[model samples]
Target: MNGTDLLALLPEGWRRVPLKATCNFFVSNVDKHSFDDELPVRLCNYTDVYKNDRVSPDMELMAATATPQEIERFHLEVGDVVITKDSESWNDIAVPAYVEGTADDFVCGYHLAFIRPRKEVLDGRFLFRCLQSRPVALQLELEATGVTRYGLPKDSIGLAVLSLPPLPAQVRIANYLDGEIARIDGLIAEKERMLGLLEEKRAALISRVVTRGLDPNAPLKPSDQDWLGEVPAHWEVQPIKYLAVVGNGSTPSVENASYWSDDGYPWLNSSVVNEPLVIKASRFVTETALKECHLPKIQPPAVLVGITGQGRTRALSSLLGIEATINQHLAFIKPHCDALHPGYLCHWLGHAYAFLRSDSDGAGSTKGAITCEQLANMRIPVPPTGEQLEICAHIRKSLDVAEPLQSEIQNSLNLLMERRAALITAAVTGQIPLEELQP
Candidate 1:
């Protein structure tokens, strides 16, 4: 918001403060040696910062290292802000969150920085919202400096400013957002629950129907594979190579930026097709670019994965959106024969995804991988073609019911977020008078 817009809403005596003056900027200086079996330091990284403005709810990971000077310098207090000091993309940068660590005196790493504010100047939550606003995010990007990739520089932070209203108005904005955002969160939480159940039901449908067929009375035999436990007597396990023609894709010339375009053929990345359903309109491709690249023509509705990337998303089982080429980081799969159900295979492959990651990342490699041989050798528990169709039908129907219910929940969550934003807009702009919330 501009100075005039803030003035239109604020009471007399209110002043806009340069962010540096409004908050105490503490530089992060994490040493790479303070890690050990320790009683003291609580490690924090960018991954710990969630969109929810919360620290990582789970404690599975820890910090790299810390120094005594670094530790004390990085101490966090309630109402203080923590944010990613730098990011590859401004959009990827997390919104500021008040200190949310579980530790009594938590320490932040180099990847993040802290902003300790004078309690009288601004409401911590409202300032956090200010940071989350699109205008602010764009500002961060436009002003940020780096060689090739833009990054927020510590020196540039103080120079950035806000159209802050009076302290009382700031509290009102924070209170409004807090009171209303909770309702939105409830909606989001419900949507998440629906999504979880849909996924579970989908998996159960796949595992059950694929292994046992539609007829329960169908005699079953033991599948000796320990991971698979058992399956129907009629069914057999086969390698992926027998079912589909698989290959890797390439980036024609990322070095030649002109090869990439917003308008043209849909160049499919594994990410574009990461849904159960076949997606259309991939990230974008060109005929020239396609001819130049060795990307195989992927048929619609093939299962896919990222052969690389450190995130769980890379390990996900996704269906293709279009007939397009894939990158090296992706491995594609398609089923063969009429009896082999594509949907059934998709559901099954999705089930095996995590197991595959664990298997590779465990002993085979410190880093996760799905080698060409490993992919070919990968086992598929196959039933008769008719039975495979039946399983696919069952899964599609269950997900058909579940997906829309989840969509509605997601829509509700969206509204809640909109409402939260609206509330902030209103209070900060004084569209809703502050007296409404005051005792």
Candidate 2:
């Protein structure tokens, strides 16, 4: 059904009101240049509205200076609602945050709009919840315009309508939501913490098994490498180059349509390195393009490492589950199977991510990358082939146990977010009365 049909379903004593009729809207005048860190005032930026339900003194707002005139024109007050006016996605546009507590020095920053509700017509908290509710949010998303960075134009937002209940009922609904959402958020946080612990445990298991071997009581010797510390006495410390044939791949020109095919050779990028085993690629290349692009076919069981990109991606390593070619940002290592197990090498590289990233040469470059020479020269702890297989098996078994628990927690978190959204929709739409929520 359309918005008009949804509005017709409002409860008794409720009426559809244009946002401009209920609130005074003001777009922020302060730009990046207006910010002065030395000033004592705080700026309520876009992130403050997008990520939070309320803007308060406790939030880490950016410090800036506004002239007395600017401050007088834009200073925030208690009960004011801040909304994101622009974002890269329409779903993020019109995100609202209620202003709470004494925020005398706070001014709206660029890309935000301040909404002050008329006391007799609207409650600030209620209005914030209404904007967040599914009906209004969907309307805002539909009205938002832009190709890359979506924006909720001031006029468009002002023209949007909300189904407003009497002030008392509005307050009650907002209060009920405040309590319920906080409880849901707490549960999500707990689940997220559990997931973090599980990840840490998984990483520790991989690091320990790969470096120290499965037999804890085995003899130890100094490896002389700072990252490896000590390995089993039987293990050898050798450069990766000596253990594998390291090479990179290429990308076919996208401008040439002939280079693309519906079903062709899988062309992997650095991103696929995040998966434990990359069995398929997001894109494919025609045989002609592969030959012209000089893309080498990476054999299965070979370790693929992301030598370029941002964050942990620069150090990510995974085993190729199929014969595929990679982009220049990825390096494939064909380990000498007779001496080193591919699984063992992949796990060791995964464990050494931090060390490898630190030793990489592109410290100051925008695209952080590890040179092929640097990767080949990097030292790794190598156990005997039999022992390497044992370690790999043990690591896999540990992950098999831990990963499911992590998945369960993640699923719970996703459900909590969905429940939160549904609760807001139900409350604001008058489908679930505040009285029904009361203990």
Candidate lDDT values, in order = 0.66, 0.82
In terms of TM-score, the best-performing candidate is 1
Per-residue lDDT of candidate 1, residues 1-439 (tens digit): 8869856655565555578888888767763345465335666666665444755324544645565666667867667777776653455553566664445446766667777778888777777777766555456656665422346777666666666777777876777677676667777677677778776876777667766678888777776667776777778888878887666777666566656778866565545435655566535667777777756777766777666544465566776756766666677776555545666677776767777777667553535666656776777788877777767777777778887877787777677677766665555544565667542
Cα lDDT of model 2 by residue, 155-237, tens digit: 88888788888999988988899999889999988998898888888888888888788788999999998667898899888
Error of 1 at 129 (Å): 2.8
TM-score, prediction 2: 0.66
- Tell me how candidate 2 scores on lDDT: 0.82
lDDT of 2 at 366: 31
**Which 10 consecutive residues of model 2 have the lowest summed lDDT?**
31-40
Please give the lDDT score for candidate 1.
0.66
RMSD of 2: 6.0
Give me the runs in candidate 2 sitting further than 4 Å from their true place.
Answer: 12-170, 241-275, 280-299, 302-317, 322-340, 353-363, 366-377, 403-414, 437-439
Q: How far off is residue 24 in model 1, in Å?
A: 5.1
